[model samples]
Structure formats: C-alpha cells, structure tokens
Target: MRRVIKNDDSEVKKSNLGYIEGNSNNNLKISKILYKEQKGFCIYTEEYLGRADARDIEHFDPTLKGTSDDSYSNWFLVKHQWNKEKSSKWADYQPVLHPTASDFNERIVYDDGDYRVSELDDQEAINLIKLLKLDDIILADERKKYIQRKAKELSIYGVSPEDFFKILIDDDIKQISYLRAIHEEFKIDIWNLLPNPQ
Candidate 1:
C-alpha cells in the first residue's frame, strides 16, 4: 500500500471534536474528506472505493476507539468488509503499519500479486501483511487483473522506462492500486517518480 499523507488540521478542527465523535452527519463529512485525501483507496486494502463500495470511518487502532485518542490521526476510511475482518484482532500486537507514520514501500515489498516484508525483514511489516490478508487469493487475483490491464495499456503505447514513468506521472491513475507491483514488474523505481509525501 502507498504511504498516506494525512491532511492538515484545518479540515478536522479540534473545536468540532464533540460533533465528530458522535454525530453520523459529521462522520460522513470526515469520511468524505479522508476519501479525497487518500485518493479514494482504502488504506488497509489499497482497493479503490467504487460507487457501490461500502466504506466507513475506521479507527486504525481499535483499542483506542472510545478513548481520547479518537482523532483524525487514528482515523481512516476503509472498506466496510475489511474493517469487519480486522475487528480488533491485532490490537495487542499492534503490528499494522501506521499509514501516515511509516514509509510503506520501504517496509513492505509488493510483487505480482503478493506482499512480503522488504529486505529489512521487518517483522511488524510481515505481521501487517498477514493481519490484513493483503495477499489473500481473492485479493491477489484482483490485483493481477489490474496489473495485466495496465501492462497491456503500457505495451500498446510501446513505452520504455522513461516513457512509462512519464505516462504514470502525467496521467495519474484515478484508482491507485497495486502500484508497487506495477513498478516492480516494470523494473522501475516508481516511488522516486512520485513527489515527496506532504
């Protein structure tokens, strides 16, 4: 999954904490903001949220749900089903990468349709992959479909590495999914081509 650079404090003002904490209306507003900030992909699954997708505001650290830690930094918009699958299962180990805190691409390697910890052999990264089922057969199959489609598109354009880089940056994919896999399959350092995280 890509590193998620959280939005600044302006949109989720501290003054609205009461409303944000309990109001469904406020939560929807916040979810929309997060969806835009995250480029319409779930932080955990890295799946695009299509019009029919069910999503909600997820507390990254489930244990902190009702505590004072319930704030934007701990919040993300995730697909509803994945959120249910994650339901406080790894709260004690806390292995999942913090979307905004960790440099994801550095800690985890994404290949064809699988994920593994990078050469760093980060145990936490490995745990995160298993905890989230990032490489489950169903998910991998979906990723492979997108990967093949993008590969075909690139092939159609007869792109070299430089040309591919330009195309990736110039026409940013509206649904950013399996990006690391695409980069690895293409033998390109796609992360370098992207601007520094905000």
Candidate 2:
C-alpha cells in the first residue's frame, strides 16, 4: 500500500517569516517593518528618519533630535529638570561632586585633605556617603565604619555626628581591581560591587 505525504509549506513559510541577509541595512529594514507593524511608531531613529523622509516631513531630523548636539543639550536640560524635581521630592537628596582622589594623596582622604578630621560637617558626611555609594570597594558595614572612623578622626574638623549614619546601600562590587583601575586611570568613581570572585 502507498502512503500519502502531507505538505508542510505553510509551517515552513511561517517559520521563515522574513529572508535573512548578510548586509546590516537589509536587516534594519526588516526590523523597521516589523517594529512599525507592532508599535505604530518606530523607536529607532534610523527607521523614524526614513519614515519621515518618505512622508516628506521637513524639520524632522531624527539625528538632531536623537543623538546630535541639540538632542544632547535638550536631554541634559530634561535630566536637570528631573533631578531638580526628584530632589524637591526628597529633602535628603543632596548633590555632591565625585572628584577623583589624587594618586599621590591618601587613597581615603576626606574633604580634600584641607580640614582634616576637625572640620567635617553634615555636608562632609553627605559627601562621604556619596563617595561610599559610588565606590564599590566598600560594603555596607565597612562604609558605616569608615564613615564613623573618618568622622572621629576629623571631629576636630567639625564633622557632624548625626549625619554620618545616612548610608546608601549599594550593589555588590564585581571586581576589586575595577574600582582601583577607574580611580587610578580614569579618575572616575564608577564602582559596582560584584559577588565574591570565584
């Protein structure tokens, strides 16, 4: 007896929804079409720009509004506004500068080494909290201890006793060297504590 074979063209066609291409532009075009179909609006600036051009919309430069200087400046303004609004909502949100500690100076000097331990105030305490939060090297307990020790050492410098407890919990630091490298080379405090190295 001969068996009849069922065709699976529909399933195959569904599986191959779109043709793959080695070129990035072809992929981008397919992505844009799919995105537009799903979301009505293209989130990608390239796709949006292309759409705008096709529609003959002038003064709709996606680059200018997406990533150029004008866009960046506008974004900065928006960010500043958001920050101000957030700070207003939270009274404790004080702005502190994160200057890279000098290599020649002590790795853990507070208040730029001018007032020593004698002149620390609420602001200084806040600053230390910011530094601790920014630095991934220190843990919660260690940060508290460091703040207390620094406060005591700088008590003569007018450090505040009450504000030293405003600790900010941080994510675990991944690599210890990551913090050191950033501080040493880039002069930036972008430490994120990771789980203990395996």
Best by lDDT: 1
RMSD of each: 4.3, 22.3
Regions of model 1 farther than 4 Å from truth: 14-22, 119-121, 159-176, 183-198
Residue-by-residue lDDT tens digits, candidate 2, 1-198 = 001121234332334433233555544443443333222211111111223333211111223332333311111111122223233333243443222222212323333211122234645334433432423233333434444454464465453322221121122121122222223332333222222121
Model 1, 130: alpha-carbon shift in Å?
A: 1.5
Query: Which 10-residue span in candidate 1 carries the lowest summed lDDT?
Result: 189-198
lDDT of the candidates, in the order given: 0.70, 0.28
TM-scores, all models, native as reference: 0.76, 0.19
Evaluate residue 4 in candidate 1 and report its C-alpha lDDT on the 0 to 100 scale. 66
